[model samples]
Target: MGKVWCVGISPTDPRLVGIEGVTFHSTVNGCDTLLVATNKNGLGGISALEDNVLIMHESLATATAKGLHRMVVLGDTSSLEGRRWKVHAESWDSTMGVSVNSIHGMGQLIVEVLARSAALKGMQVILIRVGLATERNINRHLARAFTHSSVRLESFKDSKIPDLDAWTAMCLDESGEFNSEISSEQWAPSRED
Candidate 1:
C-alpha cells in the first residue's frame, strides 16, 4: 500500500509501469516494498561468488538502511537440476520436464540472505521463481533454506510467464498471500525426526 519500487530492473511497459504508484530505481531508496529482478552477472557456478554475493549484499544493506522491510524477488529461486519446473510448498512436489543445461542462479542465495536479514529485522520476503528447468539445484536449496518465518517461496508454471501486471498487483495488494506448498518448519534441520 505504501511506496513500492522495482529494483535492479526498470518498468518500460505501461502495465508494470503504473501499479499503485510503483516506481523504478537502481537502489531500494525510500520504498516500503521492493520488486527485485535478477542480474546477468549472477548466473554462474562457484566461480561467480563475488557477483552473486555483492549484488544481494548491496541490495539488502540498502533496503535495511532505507527502512524497507518487504521485498518480492523474481528470479531462478529453484535448482531445477534436470527437471523442467517445480513448486515449493508443504513439500517439494508438482515437478515436470527436463532441462538442457543447469540453471543455478544467484537468486536463491540472494533470497536466503535477505530472508535471514528480514527475520532479524522483523520483515518479510517472497521469492517468485521464473522460467522452467532453469536451475534445479538452487531450487532444492531454496526450498530447504526457507526456514525463517520471514521468507516464502513460489514459482510460475507456464513457459511465457511472469504476468507482471498480476504479480505487481498481488505484491501491492494488502491481503494478497503467496502459496508455499510446504511449511517452513516442515523441513527444518533442527526439528527432531
Candidate 2:
C-alpha cells in the first residue's frame, strides 16, 4: 500500500505565509509525529519550491504513481474572522452536522479519483490542520461515505508558524512512497473516455 499526505492550508495569502496550517503524521524513524505550522500563513510562504506546492484539483492516484508523496490542501479557513468563523461553523453544522464532515468529503473524493487512476491502490490519506471552518462546514453525508472507504484519516494540531521547507522535507521523508524507477504520467481524465 502507498502513503498519501493530505496537507491542509488556510486560504490566507500564499505570499504572506508558506504552508503553515497543514497537518500530517510522520512515518520516518518509526515515530508518529504530527507536522504542523507555527504561524498562520503555514506552508503557503514557500510554495515556490516544487515539492511544497500541491494542486487540490489534481487526481491523487496519478500523483502517487508519479511519486507524489506530499499533498498541500488549500482550504477556506484563513479568510474567516472570529464572528465569520462562528457563522460558518453553524452553517456547516446545519449542513453536515459534524466537524470531520469536510475532511471526510475531501478524503473520499481523493480516494475515488486516485483509486480509479491506479486501480484502487492502497494509500494513506492524512488530513492536516483541519481546524474550525471547513472542519465544521463539511457535508456529513459525504464524510460518512469516506469513513467507510479504504483511505486512512489522520489529523494534526494547528501551528502558529508557516514553514514550507521544513514541512516539505518532513513529507518527503515520511509519506513519500515511490522510488526512482517510477515514472511521472499525466492523470487527467479524457472527456471522450
Candidate 3:
C-alpha cells in the first residue's frame, strides 16, 4: 500500500523545523501522497516530494518554491486576487479593504506560480480560489499567462462567501436563482421582479 503525508504550516511559524520531522516520517514510510496547508503568509519550506498537493495560505510564491517539478495546488479561489484584499477582509471584515498594490502583487504571484508549475514535465496543476463572484478581468490575465506558459488552467465557481470568494460571480448568480424562486413562490403572481 502506498503511504500519504500531510503537513500544515502557520503564518506565525513557518519554520520547517516545526513540520520537518513529521514530513520526514511520512516520506520514509513510502508515502505516495502528500498534502500541505499553509496560512496566507506562511511559505513553509522546500518540499522534497515530487508529487503532492500544495495548499498556500498567504503567498503563492512560497508554494512555487517547493519546486515539485510536477504537482497540484489547492487553495481558496480568491488567492489570485491579491493578498491585500484578503488581509483587509480579515482585519476589517470587508472586501473593500483591498489595495491596488496588494492586487498587483497577487497578480504577479499568480503568474509566477503558473509559470513555475508549467515548467515541470508531465506535471498537472490545479488552482482553486473561493468566492469568485466576478472574474473582474482576471480571466484575460490568466488566459495570457497560461497561453504563454502552455499550462492547462481550469476554474470553478464557489459561492460560500469569504471562505470561497475566488468563485466567479456568475456561479453565485446561478445560486441566487434558488432564493429568488423560493421568494416568488411565496409572493402573489403579480409581484414578480
| Among all candidates shown, the one with the greatest lDDT | 1
Q: What is the lDDT of candidate 2?
A: 0.26
Q: lDDT values of the candidates?
A: 0.43, 0.26, 0.29
RMSD in Å for all candidates: 12.8, 17.9, 15.4
lDDT of 3: 0.29
lDDT of 2 by residue, 1-193 (tens): 2222323322242321222223233322221221112123322323322222233333343345455443333322221112333444432221222122233333333432332233223333322222332322222211221222222122111132121112210111111221111111211112321
By TM-score, the better pick of 2 and 3 is 3
List residue ranges in candidate 3 displaced over 4 A. Answer: 9-29, 42-70, 82-120, 132-193
What is the C-alpha lDDT profile of model 3 across 47-161, one tens digit per residue?
A: 3211122333222343334433222232332323344545333322223422323432343345335433442433333332223333432232222222222122222222443
* Candidate 2 ranges with C-alpha deviation above 4 Å: 1-61, 77-121, 127-193
Q: What would the TM-score be for candidate 2 when compared with the true structure? A: 0.23
What's each prediction's TM-score?
0.49, 0.23, 0.30
